[model samples]
Target: METAYTIRKMEKSDLDQVHEIEQLSFTVPWSKESLLYEIEQNLFAKYMVVELEGKVVGYCGVWVIMEDAQITNIAVHPDFRGMKIGEALLTFAIQLSKEMNAKRLSLEVRVTNYIAQSLYKKVGFTVGGIRKRYYTDNQEDALVMWVNVQ
Candidate 1:
């Protein structure tokens, strides 16, 4: 079910490939500097990269605190969209969260992102609530989603 991919903790050397995947996956991607800061400054943050044949194709990140794991972002290269790579990355994130003793996982998804919603649902996330004006660019509402790890 994992295809040919392997998930491992992210490293500084993964920045370039991660940037490319981020750009390809999102309308407004996080800046490389911001990512670097997260890696360097966020003690709660845990990031992982998905590799296939020794090449990075996707990544997922979360911040674990007490009983919560807050998913920050996840992305897969455009060319690999239909390969179940996103689900694999998310599974890897969830396993990492459990390893860190998190009791739950949470995230915010744009209301219009049905594809992503489906993926989250497949992984056991459920719609929990909404945040108004969650996206600055389009004033889109964000659907809050959560999954209990225990």
Candidate 2:
């Protein structure tokens, strides 16, 4: 079953929950300090959080550089999986990239994560290349994907 969610720009209050989701969603989740650094100090970064009744359930982030936007991270809480929240977050990020004058968007997903690849494809991103041993935690390769905003 699908749950109602609201997507919006992340605020300082969401840091804790976002960090928790990152830890839950990834095998080698980023550190809380690193997330704080990105939120506090990264000028090129833009992030959004998804809430279900004011509780953060998912988040996505991207770095806008010149004419390109690179997705840095995206995750949905385990309990919220299969709710299409990830898809909504990706679409929101892509739309924001266009609004920020990005001519293209790129992201790297673990090669084994077919669900994510399918979502990217559904959102019009194409497989561009592969990054060998992209994940240090498991020595897994990544499928590089891109979407032209032109």
Candidate 3:
């Protein structure tokens, strides 16, 4: 069956659903308050959510400054993994970054997260470097990846 979903800018009302997805997808999930701050207070933040059959299934956030856009976080509901929703979210972020005049987009993924790394590579992101002990949860190193979006 074909998967149908809508991607749109995240709003305050979406935070509860987004937070649920975040908790399901991440070992270190962002708090609802943090998401609220990103949507309502952070000027550099741009966030989007994907709704599947009217339920929020995934979300992505980025911080754009000057010519650089840094992906803050991305997650899809655990029940929705392997459905290419993460890929779609990343693609949307790239296009949004380009429209905002960002020439480069970067994000860090856990070195052990081969699935996420593969998705990033498929989207043109290359490993730029490694950030030692980048993940606070287990002190795992992170692979810093970047792509030219312009």
Q: What lDDT score belongs to each candidate, Candidate 1 first?
A: 0.90, 0.92, 0.95
Q: Regarding TM-score, does 2 or 3 come out ahead? A: 3
Tens digits of per-residue lDDT for model 3 on 72-111?
9999998998999999999999999999999999999999
Q: Which stretches of candidate 1 lie over 4 Å from their true place?
A: none
Could you tell me the lDDT of residue 40 within candidate 2?
81
Whole-model lDDT, candidate 3?
A: 0.95
| Span of 10 residues, lowest total lDDT, candidate 1 | 1-10
Please give the lDDT score at residue 16 for candidate 3. Answer: 87
Query: Against the true structure, whose lDDT is highest?
Result: 3
Q: Which segments of candidate 2 are over 4 A away from where they belong?
A: none
lDDT-better candidate, 1 vs 2: 2
Instruction: Compare the candidates by TM-score and give the number of the best one.
Output: 3
Worst 10-residue stretch by lDDT in candidate 2?
1-10
**Candidate 2 on 1-150: residue-level lDDT in tens?**
557889998888899999999999899989988888788899999889999987999999899999999999999999988889999999898899999999999999999899999999999999999999999999999999999875
Arrange candidates, best TM-score first. 3, 2, 1
